[model samples]
Target: MAFTPPKETYTGKVYTLEIGVPPDTVRFGGENVLPLHGFEGIVPSRPVIAYEIQDIPPDDWPDTVKKPFKDVSDDPVSWAKFCRDALKARAIALRLIGTHPDRENRSPEDAAKTVRDILSAIDVPLIILGSNHTEKDASVLIAAAEAAKDKNCIIGKAQEANYKTVAAAAMANNHKLIAMSELDINLSKQLNILITQMGFDKERIITDPMCSALGYGIEYTYSVMERIRLAALLQNDATMQQPMLGDIGMYVWKAKETQARPEDVPPWGSLEERGIAWEAVTAIALIIAGAELLVMRHPKAIEAVEKVVDELI
Candidate 1:
């Protein structure tokens, strides 16, 4: 006798979003089942990973995470082009770390110039990020959105404090928005709803439910992302259906496990290997937890996650 395999049927679907223009666009989401649950339902596109670059040199990043791009990190345009040309990055995440009030305090105009330069240097979709300063982001992203106008970029990180301003800028410039919240399903859903309430199209929004490194509240982020995906697939929750973003490198490279020297933490083994594994593990876990888009640093880590995604899908 032959036995039948049990499969879960999903009642809802996630939206597919496209970024960049023809011949260079990338897409994700549009699945009717959970991540890689091919037997359960339809899975349209594989998850995408965007290599992370910065408008200024990543001075605060540990050497292990900084070595790969040491040659091109000095200029945002060179950095972005290297990711696209040499690294063969499908997407590039350009972070305006220099604009932070505590950092270089770069003017909005300077940010805009950087955005334009990067946009011209690469053809892949650009994920424009601010320095995580809410007040500063409100202004910086406006300039960024305008600079990348008609380029089909993703401008983001519209949190609760400044969602209105940021969402309006994204909407006005016709770019996708990233709605971020602390690692809480309820908060993530609320922020998405709020962004939509302000007349931003829900389909154009990406959700960032915050990111934590391995061994550092990562399980909490995992649980929240799982709940969000379940809500989207099982309960048919519209607000939770946006493709999730795992901003991997920032959190992973900063963790002690990734930065500690083998001499200082002898049991941890090679610091370089530990750092890459830490980032790759965190990224893979988030993907399993339902992330459809990932922003990561370190080419080896991104390559490993891409292999995992290939095997899963």
Candidate 2:
């Protein structure tokens, strides 16, 4: 008798939802709905890539990293074009960072005009970012939502701190909204629940669970996102089911792995190389853990992450 391995059970494919499902088309003017879990449908909308555009020059960014965009960074519209034309950015994220109180505190009307300029300049999907300050984002995102109302854009980051105004604006204007929370699973679900309770369509909501750099509590972030996605796909948790977003560039660029100076530590190699690696790796990690969309900076980092995405999808 030929040696035989112990009989083991074989089960049909369990249908692991490695890929997200794009939401059903709601026919909201020129915009398309993005789905997270395959339960929504087929096609995950190719995991949207939103190229970051700052309302003001990113003076806070290190010189090594900011040098690439120094030329076009002078103009927000031109910067948006560079991302679309040169970088081949599938989506654009325009941040009105200039409206912060310490900054120009530019009026909401001015920000709306800038939105018009950017909307006219590019055809790809647009994402409007508030200055991250609770008060400023509430006002600025409102203006952005109105300006790009029919053109089909995404306005974010409705948080517990400012969800009332932000959610109202995005819902009124028929734009997708990102419900953001600190790096906690419960908070993420809670925020999504609150936003939907406000009469926002469930399909139009995206979840931002907050991102952490490579070494800075990344494991916790990963676990939180992993649990969220699993609950959505397996347990069919409505609040956690919305597609998740990883603001990779923002956190990675601020971490020690990306900010370490060569002068201070000779062991660390080139700053450019380290920074790119940190961003690329962190983004890939998020995808593995079920991030359906990402907001990133740096051309090289984008290229690297795109390659990984292509292979996985």
Candidate 3:
């Protein structure tokens, strides 16, 4: 006689992807500790909306974008305060765009002083950015890092070309870092691996999968981020798990979808309203897709995205 045993079946219901970090409580300078990874805990950092300010006047910004900031465009410290006090910004990302040799060619001292001045003015956390010029950033981030010592802020988008010095600064000063790659998983992983090799801890690192605004390869950007998240959870890839960072404002504000004129495209509605919606929609998509921290621009966009986050989490 053949004996029958219990039969087990597998269910197809989707399991949530819990990627990135281990279950150990991670502390940030001893105050707040994040529980788990992957969309964990009140965003722990409330999706920091960093009002973007360049070291010099933003000439390349779209005219419509420039008009809103026209009054505070000249002074960096005043601009920093405006974003924090008036605009109600949670944080600020000061991009030293002027430091690029090809741009105004401002020196490391200039960058350092600006960082010092802004830090003095704003009580909120700051994200000190480089000019996006690889060679210049290597120098600027170090000076800015030294200027911001003990502040415990974030310094970054440290790429493969310049991670050594930047990583050292962040490590020495006890600050967070943004690891950037050119929208490639391998590159992102490689950079993260290299940075940690220099002794920076995992929690101190944030991944910039590199965001693109709507209509301009947003799908590709989103797919890359979503895949990074999936890899972290399913495969338990540590490099992929570090809290994902999105530069929503940088991409969204520059995209045509946010810039379409009412006269040119009647269906898009008011430019300002449409731009804000575009940014919020892009940001919300990222949060749902697993973004922990965001560096955004528009006030309305931040408010809208925060509400959606409140509902989702």
As a whole number from 0 to 100, the lDDT of residue 134 in candidate 2 is 92
* Candidate 3 runs further than 4 Å off: 1-46
lDDT of 1 by residue, 92-139 (tens): 998998999999999899999999988776788989999999999999
Task: Order candidates by TM-score, high to low.
Answer: 1, 2, 3
Instruction: Give the clashing residue pairs of candidate 3, or none.
Output: 20-241
Q: Name the regions of candidate 2 deviating beyond 4 angstroms.
A: 1-45
Question: What is the C-alpha lDDT profile of model 3 across 1-313, one tens digit per residue?
Answer: 8976543221111111121123311222110112123232123333445577888988877665677678997989988888878887766788898998999999999999999998777676778989888888988999998998877778996998889988998888778888999889889888989998888887678888888887777787778777776666556666667777788877887888677789999988898888888888988877766666677777777888878766655
Q: How many residue pairs clash in each candidate?
A: 0, 1, 1
Displacement of residue 310 (Cα, Å) in model 2 is 1.7
Candidate that would win on lDDT: 1
Highest TM-score model number: 1
Instruction: Report every candidate's CA lDDT.
Output: 0.91, 0.76, 0.74
Question: Residue 142 in candidate 1 has what lDDT?
Answer: 97
Instruction: Summarize candidate 2's per-residue lDDT along 80-152 as a digit string, tens digits.
Output: 8888888887778888888888888888898999999987776767888888899888988998899988665
Evaluated against the true structure, the overall lDDT of model 1 is 0.91
Error of 1 at 24 (Å): 0.6
If scored against the real structure, what TM-score would every candidate get? 0.98, 0.85, 0.83
